[model samples]
Target: FGKSANKFLQKCGVKNEPPAVKIAELLVKSSREVWESVGRDTENYKFILQKLADDFNNIEENPDLITRMKAEPILLGVSEGKKYDLDSVENIYINDDVVYLEIYNELSMIPKGYSKFLYECLGCKSLSESIKEKVEVSGNTQETKESQDLQKKLDERAYLFYCDYPKNFIRRNEGWLKKLKVKGIDKIEAKYFMKAKNNYKIRPVTACILEDQEKCIFNFYITLKPDYLDISKCLVMYIYKSRKSREINYLAMMLKAPLEDLKYSNNDANQENSQCGVDKTEYDPQIDQNSTNYDSQLEDLFKSLRTMFEDCDHDYIYHCLKQQEEDKLINVENHLMEGNYPKIKIPVNPYDPPVTIKVGKTFMNVIQISQPSLGSYLNENQTIYCKNIKDYSLKFEKFLDGIEFHIPKDIDKSEIFSRHQNSLNHFAKIIKDLIEVFDCAPKFIRIFYDKSNLMAFNQDRALFFNFKIYLDLYKIEPTIDAMTYWYMVICHELAHKFVNDHNSEHEVSIS
Candidate 1:
């Protein structure tokens, strides 16, 4: 035997030197700590046997294919708060320590087309079967019932390995978790409920981790739907084990960090990096289409902005006006020194429209009065600006009555159309929620243009207002910090609709 084979046998606690194949079997059965000892010594073992072992163990406990089969009806039953047909549940005993539930239609109940997708999408490991066959090849010619049962268990494990191992492996290397955090930029919490045609709803637990230290974010999602007996168990599992389930556990191993320690890794580095003004061209949406992982990307962008404006904080609207002032002052000083435009200086009015406002330039829209007045100049501009009005629709009736405003000409229609798709994607779920609550849909939602100090216009409009997030703020922090801007915009705009009714007055203080 070779030196690696001898070391493998010693690490596995086998006497003498096992054959090359036997050594491989022992290595497959060994724990990571044991395998690491051998792995450190030589690269003879190509496959990650320890990971495969984990894959097998994970399948034995939570066979994803089986779990998915069970999940469908259970999700339906729980959503309806009724009993699932017992025929859909199956209990299979593979061996002493490997008992798993297989979900399938009863003899009378025919399997549906969707079942195929579920089955295919779930576990499908075959390598473990080869490993098992290799291990038991010497004496398994009898084909007894016990042997058949063992074979069945091994097959099940193999299928599961096929299903989860690749995903687990990809997630570890490609930074899937990191991507999730980016997807959920402005959303603090999100609930993913999948509804089948039959009104069966599956509540999937999702967590988007922004692991800055690891330069990755983990967007973890899992749905477990077990019938009556397992419903409580599912809930219990979610509470105690779901976060640390095999999927996440394997992911943790790949990250080289424990689940608990991994919390700090969440997007803080991305957030901080974004705040640092190192590079802006890197995450430009026009240049990189794959940059649409909004959550982490936005966070990074805002972090970049924070880095640019040392006095400002992550929350965009809260400190935007101050930052804008500082920016204008810097520009004025530059102009004065270079003699580019000695006459041009920072505006005395913080929210005044710029003399040379363009469609894409960034600017802030501030109603300068100390307090927003319903009857004063605030309401006058609305009538002057909006020329085409047949009758006030219920959507903007109250808002129109409260405000008079003129839309800025600098707002670009093309830019609005271009950015609108993503902004709509950002708030689609929230819009759906509102639609459900109100029981009505508007004819259209219009996104306004960019100003000199802020990329977009006033976010106060009928039923909704749209605006652009300043690129400068994003340039500083990059991706993670950019998310703060999106959230602030959403919160500020939504507040108008949510805080009080049309006639009711609330303080509209803009800092």
Candidate 2:
């Protein structure tokens, strides 16, 4: 029957077959020899092998080590009857290729390969496989999926020991099995071993990514070896959690959606978040328009200038002028165009001979050497030759010079096609109120375009004050006596300077 079975096995194309029965006997014999070499008792040694097999079987079925007693075999080995057991086996020689064991009142030998198989049967294989699986799992989703596939292959390998090994064949290789002693596991130190793996530290949310419109959030878990506890796990966890919470907060704000709106999965949350932003755009046409405006070519320039005057910290007029000088239409000019103050044509009087007025300690002389040679009134000529912008400006300057040179009492202050100082006084009072309220003083103050309604401050010795002048151009009126009645207009400019100076000094001190 045996010969017929062998012929049938050959006919079925059995290939590369090894002697399994002989290998099993060799494994058992070698295990006994190695154990007895250290003077392990016959009965106790047998019991340990059986217990190890049972452990392997249990691991194969359930694979949970939480309730397992790691101390059981160790306590048994060190008890009164088992005292000589470890001591006796202390010097048992196990070389790279062979393990020596004592069994049935005799020493026996087994090859290293069979010993390695025995080690697997003794539960070290399960532990080794578990550790390997944990190591292979990178915790990165992309890599983890690949690892899971590899885990299936490992499971098939595991089936070799549990199902494929012959029924009566138990591998017992003491050398390889004894070598599988990680510090905590082999020594049975609960504190050290308890932290061997951090499966417990994993929260359910660790596997999920919570996201809103602004950010994607994920729970992070770290498991570290004893050596890297400080820098790797503990420290990393603290920093990671703080950063994640901030990200989530910012995301909630950006989405205009509550945290509860975020889905547990990041992909779902991201899709929903995108939809939320779209919905917001749809709700407010103005917001969408603003967004488009923000993306325009002049974005940076517009933003800087659009900030409130209070928001501008440093008085950067000189800085802006310097930028303008360096590259004609570069940084500062870009800002100028963006700010809608593109051209600054310096104001010159229309009807004055060019006169240099030097500012001195007290009252200064506004000397006008010449006036319009063509006379103040053209009786019959309905058409006047304005000629060009330059000549037109010259005439305008002459007219202003004539006004400045005349004293307040000497000039026909009321009858010169103008309203009296009544409205100017009210406007001046308003200027004083604003100045006092804001608490700022400017060095040089002026009312431009015969309009005392608008005031200008020279914050720095630069041409950039034109921007401020442009800003208030619409609010001002073209009136001749505008400055005469509004003395507080000067105070308003002074107030601007005071506020700007305080801010500039504060920023400098801080830096």
Candidate 3:
């Protein structure tokens, strides 16, 4: 796996990323989100960070840690519209965006670019925002009180963690920062640029692309020493071309030193966490451990791992096993089938008659059908058809061309602009709402089909790519329950575009 990781990195155009120097410890303020109003003091970021880093003890063995975050029910913030979680906060890492930690009514600077690097990169994204905001805004003190002390402690420590030695330390003075230029080479090359700031305390200036690539990407931890003579302290982030898109859609930061360099040099004082008070005490400001049963908890964890893999109670060898029998997981014919599926029934009038439908309390004539069904045609759904999609409702049909990207000629417009257009129009309007509420637009939307299964999207629920989403229906069902289900599924899959796994982050994003 390690060898494969190096090979993968090479494919992504990463090079020469070796282990570097370390500092003994940096003192930083800590906050705890709990009910008790006990005062907290600053502690060593190394001690606390290593504790948080321990949460990813399995990362060294994980080949994909750089791409997807291993969610651990890490909390987020609560808001009137949606609750925050690790998943929603990916922008801080992937996009140059800031989500600051509010401390004691004193706003801590979480410059947009550094916010994300400190988040998943440092495992600090789960830290609560502010104690007071949760209480006053949501009127929910119970949840906030439970984490008040811990939140407060983590808040100060988190602020110090990100700001202490954050990324893009570009403080050019006396020609201090060098370009490291070579023939036909540039470290900060890009066709597009997003605003970024330096975490340098003094003489900080906007640094151009730290390690530019063939394409543009916002993921760079751009670490530099205080003197800023082309030296690095932490893993320097690099841009990677997405294997699928062949463009800079993915970002990767060096996780840790290579396995061969696991042993930190004797001079690396702060690399190894001090056992000053790991399991011996609770809330010892001098110690890193927060709970007394830390050891027992770790023991249980190890035991669970053993049982899960070594003991064979779980299916660790699923890929190795050969399954000759039919699948026992589910039966789509009976178990997965739904009712009220055919939303539009054929009208008994073969002559088409004078068809009148009510749209929002106003009745309208059925203008013209594509191919006469019982005289009136059915749309792509084979339910009902109309002469022009615009006839259903201008409010819904407007979204087709309103999207940011041009609709590719290959995209089957039949579904979105067919006889059952009223339903499609309604869905288009919902997409518009999503765009307005989220302040972003879909690149384009297309409809596709899959005959092998009942579900087809990423999770076999709906199709999501780039910024568009669509679903191919075996039949159109206009029931409220079915419509609402599709709505939730669409939103749920959209959240996965940031955080792939379903966890607390995904939940808050949906909310």
Candidate 4:
């Protein structure tokens, strides 16, 4: 029978077969012969006969066995109990219905060949048939359909394992069966194994086996260490199927996890951890320590400015300016020379001008005395003055051409300008409130509209506002209230006047 089987295999082009196939073929045939001699009664030898019959039936019925052998034959002989060197086998034949497999123990290298005829005799469902069955199943629930898809993946993987790692499969199976103390090979039921101890600080690891009528699913559960606040858990499942006619028909693996949980866990973890090694505690200490000093200084400055504004007596100044307009007292120098008005000293940068508040018979003039040099100062006082009090008030207006503006094209130019103006007015109100309530203003305050930059500073004396920057800002953030942006910028610039340290890293903090 061995010779005939060999001849048949050679004829069918199944050469270089692995030792496992040869041993399995021999075992099937031997079991059949032994069973026939014992009158085929399974009651007396239930385990051994049943196992042998199963192996025999598998070899006889598996349709892909021959194709599998021809493609890649499985190697054997890594089992624990016995050592069988296939290389030593010399002759294999059948005599008197009993097979003879001869091995030369003295041979240094193991021989390699298996009976293709036996391999061909084994039967399994064709790949097309398996695929057809999978396609035919319908009318399943969403969950059932998902499980079916997973099963298909498992099948493909299992097939690859049977084709590539036959020896490993046998070894693993042997070990698995030994753990159960089973005397003969058969299907193993699915089971679950979880870690004996659960620790929340560390990720958990678990495993389970699920068995259906046709397939066995092995699952491994593991939790991923969180990089941030969110933690993730993964389930890797391996699918395996064994046929009555073939020990294994398919093997595959798939992974599943809760993505949202993982995402949130990571985020939460990140927030709890220190940012760039800077602790929150450290930040609080510094802020608390400097807050008092900053508050007192700001309070003192506001109080002094408020007192000065009150001293100026705005209502009286307005009345005097109105009278001057009616009287047409346009020549400020003539009025100053007449000496009919009360002269009040106004604080300003001495380098620029010496500001003087003058009240005439029917007018009030805030004059700046410009001198070319200290010698000229000793000689005369030439006046440059603002006769109208309205001219001294801060104004925010459109300073840039709408066409050159780089804001969103979709927004109307007029609308953007309006928002920009509104922002400035809102900020101006905040400044006024601060000055009135806190009783403070910069010693020499002046505001100008210019196209050169968003804002320019000359100590606290001069502030230049540009329309383009604020318009662009409003365009970029339409949702943000214009007043909020303006308030922040004004406060920031005002804070700079107080600190005056361009290099200070805590400038923003102080502000």
> Whose TM-score is greatest here?
1
Structural similarity to truth (TM-score) of each candidate: 0.18, 0.15, 0.17, 0.17
By lDDT, is 1 or 4 better?
4
* Model 4 clashing-pair count: 33
lDDT of 1 by residue, 1-511 (tens): 3433243333334455233334334433443444355443212222222122213323345454445444332111111122222122222111100101111111111111011111222322111111111000111123334324323332222222222111212223222211332121122222222121122222222222223467543322211211222222222222221111233333323333333553433255345433521122111111111111113223333344434443321222112222223353344233234422112111132122335323321112211112211111112232111111222222222112122212355444455446554543433333333323222333223332234232222222333332333332433433334443443443343333323333334224111
| Residue-by-residue lDDT tens digits, candidate 4, 390-448 | 22223333323111113222335566455465654533443333222222342223333
Better of 1 and 2 by lDDT: 1
Largest lDDT belongs to which candidate?
4
lDDT of each: 0.27, 0.26, 0.26, 0.28
All candidates: CA RMSD (Å) = 32.4, 38.6, 29.6, 41.1
Model 1 bad stretches (over 4 Å): 1-407, 410-444, 452-464, 470-488, 498-511
Q: Candidate 3's residue-wise lDDT over 224-273, tens digit each?
A: 21111111111111111101110111101111223244343323423332
Worst 10 residues of 2 by lDDT: 96-105
State in Å the error of residue 501, model 1.
14
lDDT of 2 by residue, 246-326 (tens): 222332232333335533344443455443111111112211111111112333443345342212211131223322323
TM-score of 4: 0.17
